[model samples]
Target: MLPRVVRFDLLFVRTDYSDDDAWRDALAAATAVHPSNDFERCGAALQPVESPELSGLTSAQLVGLPRADYLAELAVADAQTMRDQTVLFVDLNELNKQVGRTFRAIPSQVEPIVANFSIANMDFHEFADNADPDGVFRGFTR
Candidate 1:
């Protein structure tokens, strides 16, 4: 049998928690099992933008903005910058182990956070080439 390639779609819900801090803490805990590179491969980032946009906007234009305004702008910009979906590829046998690892690595308090998120899986198989000319007709008749 061929090794199956499984794809897991991890969907994040922004409103799962009541507050930003709780959500951030939950996310941190959930992602603690994997490194930034892993998340990157899955088309996600653990952190927000590293630098704020400073080239176009003047200091004068940014100076008077409220803290909430800045945060909101950053959120919008970050959302626009990052990929909208995250997908992870794994071997079929490793899928269950990976889930177990993630669950075990996260703190008990944040276990519910991981539970709230959903993972959907898909399996892909590679096409095989037949060596014999009669292989295609093995199960067919004229």
Candidate 2:
């Protein structure tokens, strides 16, 4: 028998190497606007994450729980612990397919990290991508 595992796109950028406005850029990368062709006004709450927030959290913590609890957890996360990691969980299926999405949070010197984690099969694999000097992931894979 196979156990089920939910799959979502996990994107991350290290704050230490990115531009000073990394958080704002990260937020922009998370949004897509093409349903009515207007700016998206609402979506997930962006927050800092560490133990429990990232490790101990369950599927329900993201899709089922109230935003307040999650936000509260983020509020107390040790700023020191969150020093350089910036991560966002997204669903490519939920995004507007009509629009083109380019990954921009990673820097050129930083080789982009792309991977697949499978729970049903209990395995993980990493894929590769080529990056320009500016760090935007152009559609081709290396």
Among these predictions, the greatest lDDT belongs to 2
Error of 2 at 40 (Å): 16
Give the least accurate 10-residue stretch of model 2, judged by summed lDDT.
69-78
Pairs of colliding residues, candidate 1:
none
RMSD of 2: 13.4
lDDT of 1 by residue, 19-125 (tens): 44554555554345443321222222223222233223322343333332111111111121122211111112233332111101112212222222222221111
Q: Candidate 1 regions off by >4 Å?
A: 1-8, 34-142
Candidate 1, poorest ten consecutive residues by summed lDDT: 69-78
Candidate 2 lDDT over residue span 1-142, tens digit each: 1112223323231223223364444444433221322233333222323223344332234333333211111111112213332232222222323111222322211122222221222111111124344434332334
Candidate 1, residue 36: Cα displacement in angstroms equals 18
RMSD of each: 20.4, 13.4
Candidate 1 Cα RMSD after full superposition onto the native fold (Å): 20.4
Stretches of candidate 2 exceeding 4 Å from the true structure: 1-25, 34-128
